[model samples]
Target: MDPEDGSGWADVSDRSHRIDDEMDRIVERLRDLAHTQRRFQDLLDAVMSVGRDLELPVVLRRVITTAMGLVDARYGALGVLS
Candidate 1:
């Protein structure tokens, strides 16, 4: 906008609002990235936890519990097929 008459003030205001809206979108995307990263880390930790056990019974239980925790499920089960 011209400093003397400020004839372009409306255009400048519109551009500023657009930029602010774009910034908000960018921030939301960053938050999503952070959440995804945390979930990935949790999965890695669960893998390590299951790996550290050498007993079959303990391993199976850990797998079920870990699956439930990862998916936020109230119930989990294990099925065997031969």
Candidate 2:
């Protein structure tokens, strides 16, 4: 029976396997793009939130916390050169 036929076994031809592999790669790339987009949006929102605060300390704390959370870091700190 031809592999292309809707038999119980999957198609094992080289071209078919290559197509499947390419499809899997495309799906993985799309997922990564979606995750990155979400992170970017979260960062943008964090920046906007800090922008609304007029107090310096509050703004600094918000920025540090937001940065830590976005990067999944357990600890974060900010240093001023001046």
Pick the lDDT winner: 1
Q: What is the TM-score of each candidate against the true structure?
A: 0.88, 0.79
Question: What would the per-residue lDDT of candidate 1 be over residues 7-79, giving only the tens digit for each residue?
Answer: 7898899999999999999999999999999899989989999998899999999999998999999999999
Residue 36, model 1: lDDT of 97
Alpha carbon lDDT at 52, candidate 1:
88
Cα RMSD for candidate 1? 1.6
Give candidates' CA RMSD values in order: 1.6, 4.4
Off by over 4 Å in 1: 2-6
The Cα local distance difference test for each model comes to 0.94, 0.89
Name model 2 segments beyond 4 Å from true: 1-12
On a 0 to 1 TM-score scale, where does candidate 1 land against the true structure?
Answer: 0.88
**lDDT agreement of model 1 with the native:** 0.94
Q: Put down candidate 2 lDDT per residue, 1-82, tens digits, no spaces.
A: 4556646345346668899999999999999999999999998999898999899999999999999989999999999898
